[model samples]
Target: MGGESNRWAASGRKATAVGTIAFRQQLAYKTDFALRGFFLLFILFVFIQLWTAAYEGDFDKAISGFTLKQIVWYLVFTEALTMAAPPLCSRIEEEVKNGDVAIRLIRPQSYVGYHFSVFASEALTRFAVHLLIGSAIAWPFVGPPSFGGGWLGLLALSAGALTVTFLLLLLVGLCAFWVEETSGLYFVLQKLQFTIGGMLLPIDLMPEWLQRVCAWLPFQAALYFPARMAVHFDPALLVKQLGIQIGWIALLAFAVNRMYRRGVTKLHVNGG
Candidate 1:
């Protein structure tokens, strides 16, 4: 049993390395990595201006416990999370539609595992790019260091949230096996995530009931919870949010594995 477990760990590490290589190749060949910084800066600049204008009209210096600087920084973090997700949904849907799953099945790796590895490296690279550029763009407006020990906590939480994001998207993409196309579902999810996942605004700004609901759900944890942690720096809340985020990741990981197992059997039954 110990040997088998060790083997699995080694395979998972190998898969992650393969994924990192794949992303590196994609970045090298597909997009100009150098230009991504400027693009992210442009996007951040727009958000900063929007929030700055919003703050000007308000009399109180704080809105929903966030100052103007925190608000802009919040948008930056949320956008980084959103931008990090590779378009796994579209890729999976295409593969399923074109019967490419058959080819993937013959590979030496778990198809879903391979995809998850790719998702991990790609998302992390994109997240880092977005974070650096977003920070630079906000520096002149918001000024110096706004995070400390909370940075490490937020960093860990962000990793968990990114995992959850990838798993959910992969599951949604796998829906193509049954639905013939999953774009409609993916579209709905994207909109819901943007609105309720705390991409456009913080979860705290929502109605009290809605805030309570989002707190328990997976949406808020993905972006808002971690971003909130970064700026707020409550050790107690940090422990609570990390627990919730890890719990959600566990649940989502189980769901993804179950769905993938079922989908594989169905594909074999139908296509084999």
Candidate 2:
């Protein structure tokens, strides 16, 4: 039994190693990733131009909180941040629906850990690419954001925001165990987040009630809160938002673990 467990542990490490290698392999296609990044930069430029035109004359002086240049820079940061964001939750659901997850289940390793390891590896790779080349291009065109809070607080809040986003999506993916076909549902959810996640516009720019609603949703923590941390450095607000992000991460991680176990049981029962 001890020997068998050792072999199992070795196999798990091998699988995770393969996943890490595959992440690098995907990133090696520099042409594709660069093109995608370029498109993002181009889109930011177009939006900036439109906003610049709109803000001409009296509108320029009248606008209060964010100047035209600041808004342009916000678009730059928004593009970089969104590009670095993880893939949609639907990928895991697709794997389950297509029975691809069965292959992983046959291994001695934990399926949840394996998938998350793969995700984390890919996210790290992408983030590096974004910070290096992507940021270089965007930063020159637009100045860095003026953050109001302490740097450490903003960093902590950003970390919490990333954790919350990952956990929420993991929970969403685990829901596929019961729902079977969750792509359609995720599509609608994605649309909602795109519209209300405040990735496209600052929640502060929206109506008071809309901002209140955004505050409660997990989607806001995903992008808006982190972006706020980048631009506004209020430690008190950062602490409050970080607390919310941590709470969501904890709750979602627990919920997803339960769902994952239940799903595995169902898979075994169904003999899939």
Assess candidate 2 and give its TM-score to the true structure.
0.80
lDDT of 2 by residue, 1-272 (tens): 99999988897787679677858776788897888767776776677667767677222342437666556655554455556556647777777778888888876667776766666666656655654554555456555544445345545655565666567667777777778767676677666666687767877788889888887788777767766566666767877888888777878788878888888898888875
Q: TM-score for all predictions?
A: 0.91, 0.80
Model 1 per-residue lDDT tens digits across residues 38-108: 77788788877788898893524898898887787777788888888889999888888888888987887
Model 2: per-residue Cα lDDT at residue 272 = 59
- Pairs that collide, model 1: none
Clash pairs of candidate 2? Answer: 148-233, 149-233
| TM-score computed on alpha carbons, candidate 1 | 0.91
**Any idea how many clashes model 1 has?**
0
CA lDDT, every model vs. true structure: 0.82, 0.68
Number of clashing pairs per prediction, in order:
0, 2
lDDT for model 1 comes to 0.82
